[model samples]
Target: MTRVVGKRAARRAELFDQLVGLFLDEGFAHLTLDDVAARLRCSKSTLYTLAESKDDLVRAATVHFFRRAADEVEEALARVDSGAGDRVTAYLEAVGDQLAPASARFMEDLARMPGARGVYEQNTAIAAERVRTLIAEGVGAGEFRSVSAEFVADVVASTMVRIQQRDVARATGFDDAQAYRELAALVTRGIAR
Candidate 1:
């Protein structure tokens, strides 16, 4: 029984990964269950085991992508033993790297869907708080100049929201990943002692 359960879990995980990759490459806005099943080479029943409906599946995939990205970002940050500035840069660049794989269409679809967008917004808020903590630590450690962590975090969060909304892309002709890279450089230079 345990063996059967483990195999089922592994299969589900494999399907979930394939689904995410498909969604990342091509937007999920137009893909139907039949399309998904055909692309994944699995039955509709197998997709149902992942999510109840198409929207639910998209949300699940978005959640999975963000969760995996967060884990990777933290792992990347952990590898940095340097000062807080380097840590902040590392965190943001890691975020950029994680997001680089997503297509513009996927991002557009994400913004259009409320459930998926909510997950993204929630993650952005959490990331803002994380940035706030990193800035505070930098200040305390004398690695960064005396700047208001709250203010800096608020700025970063606002920029992230704009990036998510596609305003930055429209205005600067930069993708989300490129915008994040520019943001990291700007913030590190702005806050440096």
Candidate 2:
């Protein structure tokens, strides 16, 4: 019984990993459960048993990506070797690192499916709130000057959104890391006494 349970768990993990890899590599819109099953050399029934639907698989994949990203951001923020400004910088850099590839493919996928826009927007807002909270903490520590944390957060969020926009991504040479660094510097200066 224990061996059977462990085998099932391992199979589910393998399926989930394959689904995420396919979603990231091929773009979610381009793949189907059949494609996934085919790629995994598994039966459609097996895939369906693991995920109720393709939408479920996509949602799971997205959640997995964001959860990993959130963990990285949290870890970056908790680093004692860095000051508030440096921590903030590390946080932004970490975000850019995740967003660079993901956003490009996501934007392309979302362009064709309007329904997914809401999910993307909600996630963006959450990221902004997190950044805003960080700014607020910095201000409380006297690392940042007196300024509206909400407004600063909005600016950072909006800038990131713009960066994700298709034309801006292309115009900026896809160097979101550079853009994020510059934006962080600008924000840092704005709130610095």
Candidate 3:
């Protein structure tokens, strides 16, 4: 019985990862369960069994993305061997790297769909708080200079979002890596002591 439950849980996690990858590759607004099922070569009913609804899928996908992002940030922070300023730069660069893709389309879709606005806003608030907590920890450890952790976190999050938006706009016009590099440099300068 335990083996069966574990197998089921593993399968569910696999489906969730597949769905998240699809959402990131193709904008969520343009993606459908049928598409996910087709990609998985499974039935839509199977996806519904895994997720309660489309909204549930969106929430799960959002959580998955943020969780992965937080892990990467943690790893980047761990790698920083320099002062608070350098650590701040590492963190900002890590964040920009995570958000450089799909950031613009995600925001545009959220704005266009009134129904999703609340969920998006709630998710953003959660992300901001997570960043704030991380910044507070960095400050406590002297890995970040003295500053209002909450305010700096908010600015960092907002800056990342805006940079991603601009990246999407210039997707065809400019290289994403170049844009992210420039933005990271600016953010690092602003946050550095």
For candidate 3, what's the RMSD? 4.1
- Which candidate should be chosen as best, given lDDT against the real structure? 1
Q: Residue 164 error for model 3, in Å?
A: 6.6
lDDT of 1 by residue, 25-100 (tens): 9989999999999999999998888989999999999999999999999999999999999999999889888989
Candidates ranked by TM-score: 1, 2, 3
TM-score of each: 0.98, 0.81, 0.70
Local accuracy of candidate 2 as per-residue lDDT tens digits, 76-115: 6677465667767777877777655554566567545544
Candidate 2: give the clashing pairs. Answer: none
* Residue range 67-147, candidate 3, lDDT tens digits: 777688779879988766566567656755775565446746554554455555554566557557756766787666677
Clashes of 1: 0
The TM-score measured for candidate 2 stands at: 0.81
**lDDT by candidate, in order shown:** 0.93, 0.72, 0.64
RMSD of each: 0.7, 2.8, 4.1
* Model 3 TM-score on a 0 to 1 scale: 0.70
Model 1 — which ten-residue stretch has the worst lDDT?
11-20
Number of clashes recorded per candidate: 0, 0, 0
Clashing pairs in 1: none
